[model samples]
Target: MRTTRSRTVAALGVCSALVAGPLTAPAAADVADLRLDQWGLDTVGAAEVWEETRGSGVTVALLDTGVVTDHPDLDEVTVGPDLTGQDLSPDSDGYGVHGTMMAGIIAASGHGIEHTGGVMGVAPQAEILSIRVAAEADAAGGGETDPGALAAGIRHAVAEGVQVICIPLPDAAFSVQGDEAERDAVAHAVDNGVVVVASGGADGEAVYPAAYPGVLAVGSVGADGALSEFSSRGEHIALTAPGEEVTVLDADGGYTTVTGSDAAAAFTAGVAALIRAEYPQLQPEQVAEALTGGAVAPAAGAEQPGHGAGVLSAPGAMAAAGTTAESVPPFDPELAEQLADDPLVPRWVLWTGGAVLLVLLAVVGLVVLRRRSADPYGLGRRTPETERRPVRGRRRRGRGRRGVSR
Candidate 1:
């Protein structure tokens, strides 16, 4: 695993509204009032999307530092293996802080007393699978987390049959050379019809495995629907979500607002969960298309390079029709012909050609040796110096004593 300086944006203190006072308890008949303070809910049309599905059957895998499984907002979270090499419990305070925050953003259920009118996620009913792959020590020490652990976590999520994999960390956590195992694991997830969502880096550079093909790269946008300056920009970005000033439950049982592409990715993953629950038959690519195609255009003058399709709209995606596998168009004949004529050969063919060449060279070497051994006086061979000595002696005697002496 490659190590580098930490690039994750730390979570800021809770939003001002939550700090003012404890939320008033909702009346028994009005459960909708419980989430009135969640601006993100309304901004992304979560309430309307909830009418169709709350992501009941979808399981979103959170591959991060860890999660506070016992938090009021995260009652439905299931703690998975700790790939970070830390033996801490899922609800541990110090190490799992970042992962806990992301969990609240995705599937916080708000089940405890202190959270009665607290933070509610986009997919309030979705289940969270907390897979701890990021190391707290590495992060604090300004070192990159293990990419192998991340790759293993992705494979584990796929094996568990998760519908969505949410990586709420930045690009710097990955190696510059790109870990082949991590990339292959992500590809495996996509091939198995799993939606992989990752944060576009905060420093305006493309990041992996977000930059990898078939992954949904998310950028950050603010509540006002403008692109956040810190959000990374690139052609790989698939969509933008409300990332700035986004309120989420922290590890200390408090609400806090975070700003970065991590929050955007978590929010986008939640939206993906909603889509999966509403349209279980849709393939990963089709689900991605729904999110991108259904995104609302940003306000004038607010668009940025990484602000991909636009800001996420849960209601729009949920209401959008699902695409069947057969709906995809066939490959164009011209493109197919071009590919056939391309000089780049497949890996298997290259290996086979190399093996054939080695065999041919060995056969040629053996044939040359055999031909030389069979005919000692072959045309290509030179006569021994001893045989030519007699001829020279005859010539010298014939010439005269003076010639021989000369």
Candidate 2:
């Protein structure tokens, strides 16, 4: 519970999109319409993105398992990496497979590769830099967890000068804390002006980067514009995105409806890309404002705080950015439904999210308990957890001598 959203805003530097709410599964008939670009806002942002911007000259950093570099639909995406390893698409496991789907939403280009599959990229012209860190989960529901790799990826992403960084993974526990490398990387990205987009964890507790003041913490919303059960809440969240049933290509060359903050994040990232693509003149801050401010509040009494401004509407966003799209009123559920009948988001997001929240509480409890044992005034506090004296070269006060007491 940190109260300040300043850091979250700085990190995301853009608005997050809220899903229309849980959607029905697409019928076989709907499958034919399946395209990676099937995000609800796809049509709305297309004109602005295609005519004004294709995410061209922009590189979005997908800091996740990894993007499917060789996918037919991902011609525009360029593979980038961290200290961990390669950017292998169609790889085994469920880990980074999600990354490809997320990337497709932001910058998939189905041309050149035949039958690129059900998903089409949102920002077809935008490029992607892969920052893979985690491994796919095994049947036992466990895989190698590597925060270091995540930290490395963040730094690498900043160094590479990515304009947007999508962090799909949630830190294990807020108490787990981020490694120095990760914090420094985020700081560097902010200093250099990279917009960071992250998902709110299943837990109500805000996760890092997302919780971190500069990051744009995002929660999930469904087709009805109601907050998804799985979407994390609280002050850390800066916006919401279409998280349920959105279609994207998997690493295994299949199309599936996904429901996670990750998918929502992808759509949000795409929206940001659309704005940047159209209004390169708009700074990250301005881009965020336009997206959040332009979003129509969900129905009356349905609005939630921390989700920020409102659900993203690409049409509204374009208008706000002054892209000259046709003048249109805020979102109307009936009108949107008429435009497309697809299901990428589901209602179970919350039921599944409860477990996650429990874990976060445990982490917080542990951290608090540990902190109580340590000396509160300890200046030796290091990052992550526990406490320690300053590293070598640092001096401690002796008698106000103001000199190194080494």
Candidate 3:
């Protein structure tokens, strides 16, 4: 129920691609070709991922403006709380503009018998849990950014058992310095095994929630696979995705081209959803590793300025996930038995112990020499057994002396 006065900007720019508002139905065959223009989907390798899974059975918690569920391409959308304290009805101005765009980028289902036309998200089968945490636009053409609402939304999403949480604010709408509530909320989500994804801010600053320790901070890339001019740089960036001029749903149920960190974050979240759907048992950090570890940079060992690990590759991530899953063997009593055949102590430990024993014996011999020199009746003093068995070097001399005397 917390609120704030800080304004949140949905995207850096929004340009009308097709006519805004409800669109006339196009030819049935032409509908399927609508996705051909969506270069962002191809950039992220959504087709290859579709062959495996479309993020089925995964729910993405979108903490942003409210979303419009009537979009033809969008699948199931469950509306949650409205923390913005504003009217989120369809009649409202700028109703869910940004949120709708993010939803489409994550899980927009094509419209038609063949599921063609409109936008197709990376994880088209994934469901959406919409929680309005900020206003897309206000009456004066400006809206407030509420970190309090964001924190509350995160906790609520975790409570709802969401696998992935997406925050599409690609700008530093407000400062999160010393925002313990927001920090704790993100931590709570990650601790519950939820994968938190956010944009690194288009203003070239590493923003909060995204800057939070466990969240996956995403950056922006263009269709050419180059870093976007607006994407933020620095160590906080974890991955990059197509964001500039990306195709998404407009507030009026039509398609539009928008540019910002929002698309980047949404695409990354969709990838996270796909990973979750494919490997439900993978931990949050392991999912993140599959993403960053599998990203392909522009060149081998060459770093992209703001592209984090590099551009997101869905197939590569899945491959890395496979390797990771194979390496992390599941619980098996037979596997334990297989390892039990090996020695309990390592070779290094045995070698080290032997060397240490030799050193200790030498030290004891030196100590005895010193003690015998100081006190004739000490440890070095000869006992009866030593007298009977003469010292090796003296035994020969003693026999020769006995022979000479005889």
Best by TM-score: 3
How are the candidates ranked when ordered by TM-score, highest leading?
Answer: 3, 1, 2
* lDDT of candidates 1 onward, in order: 0.75, 0.62, 0.78
Query: Cα RMSDs of all predictions?
Result: 14.7, 27.0, 13.3
Q: Please give the TM-score that candidate 3 achieves against the real structure.
A: 0.72
TM-score of each: 0.70, 0.64, 0.72
Off by over 4 Å in 1: 1-37, 91-93, 112-116, 137-139, 171-176, 323-406
Candidate 3 worst ten-residue window by lDDT:
8-17
Q: Count the backbone clashes (under 3 Å) in each candidate.
A: 1, 41, 4
Error of 3 at 283 (Å): 0.6
- Candidate 1 lands at a TM-score of 0.70
lDDT accuracy of residue 2 in candidate 3: 10
Instruction: Name the better of 1 and 3 by TM-score.
Output: 3
lDDT by residue (1-406, candidate 3, tens digit) is 0112221111111112133433334443345455566888888787897888999889999988889877777878998888877746754767788788889999998764456456688899999999988876443325456778889999999999999999887353545463789999989999998999988875555568778989898888877777877777767888888887776787676777778877888999999999888877788999999998888785432364576788898888888887888866554434566668755788789899999999999999999888778988645666787777545553443445554654
Compose the digit string of candidate 2's lDDT tens values, residues 176-257. 2555666776777777767777777666665665666557667777776788876776766767777777766656555555
The predicted structure with the larger TM-score, 2 or 3, is 3
- Using lDDT as the yardstick, the better of models 1 and 2 is 1
The deviation in Å at residue 92 for candidate 2 is 5.8
Best by lDDT: 3
